[model samples]
Target: SVTGNRVAHTANIDRIAARGATFHRHFTPNQICSPSRATMATGLYPRHHGLWRNGVALDGRLPNLWQALSLAGYATKGVGKLHFQPLLAPVERDMPESLAYWERPGCEDWHGPYFGFDAVDLVMGEANEATRAGHYAAWLKRNHPEVVDLYEPDANPDSRAQDLNEVWKSAVPPELHYTS
Candidate 1:
């Protein structure tokens, strides 16, 4: 495909390709987001990991790359998006609505064996680019209040939880955008 790609000519991928062989195909066990993440993290097929759908996620019960490394005495830290749990569901009926893995208030306090990560700055809400409000949100709150409203516009402390808007674009500055 790079044969016809104008931008590809400017990319250093050419150097990499010259040093190696180029192939167009790749493999994955599943197409769903959390399941695919779990597969890579846990090194298990979707069925084996017991997270075959979007609303479910792997918990402490599973063995993952982080856990293996941590067990061997590595000091682990995860920043940015790490979807170790399901965003749509509660952890347990008795437990309070599950704490987010991303930049949740107390999330930074818990030094866990969480999905093998000793510490995490998690970002959930992969459903919509506009929906993420985790550590990144906290960062904005601390460093730049003006940009905070753009990402979590309805996250008014005065208001109770509002339903998130689905599949939409935010006109927030590109400098403030996660993709940028």
Candidate 2:
């Protein structure tokens, strides 16, 4: 099964179309992770939310989906990549630090416990660094061994023998779950 962009290209597009819904225009507030994710969480366009670039922290005063869901008494759990933060802030830093970047510091740590989500499997600002740790690459190796060699930078036998942990595959499924 494909995930992210691959799924967008193959399954997600067709699946949306199959439901008699047209896949119309889409736009991201920012091309980078932190800003785009802030837009999604806060339900505000980038200009209004002010997370215009990568490493920018989300303005905490803005009400995000989690808070809204919590107010509505829905169990709003967050998982995977929620890239909200002040530009260049790390996970450990809290509100005071965030206020330096933002005029109002609301949700200082995007991945830390916030709103009312009962459970969250979150990764903070470091997307690229996490990917290099080999979770996805390892899952790809186990599930699609045939193409493993194709991804190698060189033909060395030792390099090709790298094994990734199977537990990493236990994360979310590659497909989006929709409820009618």
lDDT of the candidates, in the order given: 0.59, 0.48
lDDT of 2 by residue, 79-174 (tens): 554556553454456432232323333332333345345555443223123222122323444565454444322433333223322111112223
Clashing pairs in 2: 55-87, 56-85, 56-87, 57-85, 57-86, 57-87, 60-106
User: CA shift at 110, candidate 1, in angstroms?
Assistant: 3.8
| Per-model TM-score on C-alpha atoms | 0.63, 0.50
Against the true structure, candidate 2 reaches a TM-score of: 0.50
Candidate 1 structure lDDT: 0.59
- Candidate 1: tens digits of C-alpha lDDT, residues 1-180: 244563223235666677898777987798977789889988999889988877675765888888888899999987656665655554342111134334344653444445777876655454234244565555656677777566653543432333334323444565765544
Predicted structure 1: clash tally: 3
Q: Where does candidate 2 have its weakest 10-residue lDDT segment?
A: 164-173
Those runs of model 2 whose alpha carbons end farther than 4 Å from true positions after fitting are 1-22, 86-92, 95-112, 124-128, 131-180
Candidate 1 residue spans exceeding 4 A from truth: 1-23, 91-108, 127-132, 152-176
